[model samples]
Target: MKRLRIISFVLSTIVFSTTLLTTVQAQGDKKSTAILDAMSNKYQKIKSFKAIFTYTPDGGKSLKGDATVKGTKFRLKMAGQEIFNDGKLMATYIKETNEVNLQDFDPSAGGDLDPTRIYSAYKKGFKYAFLQERKEGAQTFDVVELTSTGKNSQVDKVQIQVNKADNSINSWKIFQKNGQKVTYKVEQFQPDVAVADNFFTFNAKQFPGVEVVDLR
Candidate 1:
């Protein structure tokens, strides 16, 4: 009877220890979550901004673009050629042989891309951990990581440089577990610019003999 009591006490002690450890770990996770959410909140507050961007991959030709943002309007294009997508913008592009027209958009496309809205919906889509400080030309930054929440998402893990002076995202490096990787470097950020009302319009009459695909 004494042996039975001893065994029962031992089992109870083990269970109690496990429960305590589990509680501690859960608390730690919650605290970590709060830190990340704070950073994301700062990210979502910008109404408009601009930047000069360059992208270079391991073995591909570098591409450059000027990125302009006005409220939810966005325009990103490379030299005279580009692939542009905007949810709240209308822009025009005309070439000797072709022309493109755009209408305002809802900006959220099937959850792939949302300006700072990603954090509000999928805060855990990224893992937030700090890295060493880095300083560049007139820019000091802290690194935060956003990795695929899924095992098979083709997009790679992204490392973003948060500008120390403004708390804005400045640059990105990508690491693909299942695909190719790229690095996007934004050199300049302009937060002041008046975006015209017609900046988000698609006028086919403006460009005759041009293919007008409705992407709205």
Candidate 2:
């Protein structure tokens, strides 16, 4: 199912739970570099934002989803035939439980998944090669591609859209060397939010008949 596939990529990785792992290994140097430090003078610093997503698998109808990231944590909702009907479903394909529940799994849930892990992961994740420059919106963006080494070698090319005005990242694309591609767009952003700790914990008993299927 198209919807399920979208959820798979989003849920499996968790906004680079493992994608940007290799972001720290390389820096841009002219020629093939994609890092645009000069253009990041503005619009590169995102405190928080919301994004409406459409996945183009070689360009079909585009799998739809919405993602909102603030600080180090984010919420992603994908359009699923069964779950999207009401548009309230947030997928949780828990590896530990092997259950695919239509429930929002807070990034902080279960053993404290530090929300900022994704952003800072690249600080020490992997190696990279920067590419050319491109303009998006009012900002000039630099594209930095990543190469996963050692155990991460299978990660293929991960392209990051860097803000020229600021060092912050604008968007990123991940493509498996085998050919699976995923694009994440930063729609709207804010610096921080007042989120309750309870947001991540949900008692399945509250939702009667919620589909719970083991994924592992």
Candidate 3:
């Protein structure tokens, strides 16, 4: 269950990170919105993309993961597990157990972890503003902050850093209501990568002696 939860959260994060500024509310400052718009336009032109990221939860060790996304399909490799979602079905393979769980994929089913809704979350429940600009060596980043307005919101705050050079996302930090924080940093991003539809499907022949659990 814990692993499933992690996968759900990470999957949602990957989608949200990739489409970060698309649906931001109009309440944000003009500078922030302008930066976001540029970033959105940059990503929208790409048909497919691949990213390598580092995930670190509060009080936990950092883990490195890579994900490839093509439209609604995605393949994620992280923490000894590989998740494949071909838009309609999802398969989660655990390396330790040599087992794969297959189930129907519904982006709208998981509340809070729903990738489809996460794109519009900021427009509804959060207030956003331009925080500041930070310079790291030769690169400049625009930082934007979003605060949850609802008292019952699971997330308290979110901070995003966008690279000024190419309008790409650099990293994001999520602060939960329970005082826990999760950070995701993009190590590398490749847009317009060549990939086939079969790349997002799970093949049984790839793993010998693997147990398959079909829950769909």
Off by over 4 Å in 1: 1-39, 79-110, 116-124, 137-139, 205-208, 214-216
Better of 2 and 3 by TM-score: 3
Question: Residue 115 deviation, candidate 1, in Å?
Answer: 3.8
Best by lDDT: 3
lDDT of 3 by residue, 87-153 (tens): 8999999999999999999865654434534444556667778999999999999998878887866
lDDT of 2 by residue, 68-128 (tens): 5544344555543222111223445333333455644343332111223544433443455
> Which residue segments of model 2 deviate by more than 4 Å?
1-8, 12-54, 68-74, 81-116, 151-154, 211-216
Candidate 1 TM-score, C-alpha based: 0.64
Cα lDDT for residue 140, candidate 1 = 83
Q: Rate the local accuracy (lDDT) of all candidates.
A: 0.49, 0.48, 0.78
**All candidates: CA RMSD (Å):** 17.7, 7.4, 2.6
Looking at model 2, report the run of 10 residues with the lowest lDDT sum. Answer: 80-89
TM per candidate? 0.64, 0.59, 0.87
Kindly report which residue pairs in candidate 1 clash with one another.
Answer: 87-105, 89-200, 90-199, 90-200, 90-201
**Clashes in each model (backbone N, CA, C under 3 Å)?**
5, 29, 0
**Where's the lowest-lDDT run of ten residues in candidate 1?**
13-22
- Cα deviation of 113, candidate 3, in Å: 6.2
Q: Rank the candidates by TM-score, best first.
A: 3, 1, 2
Clashing pairs in 3: none
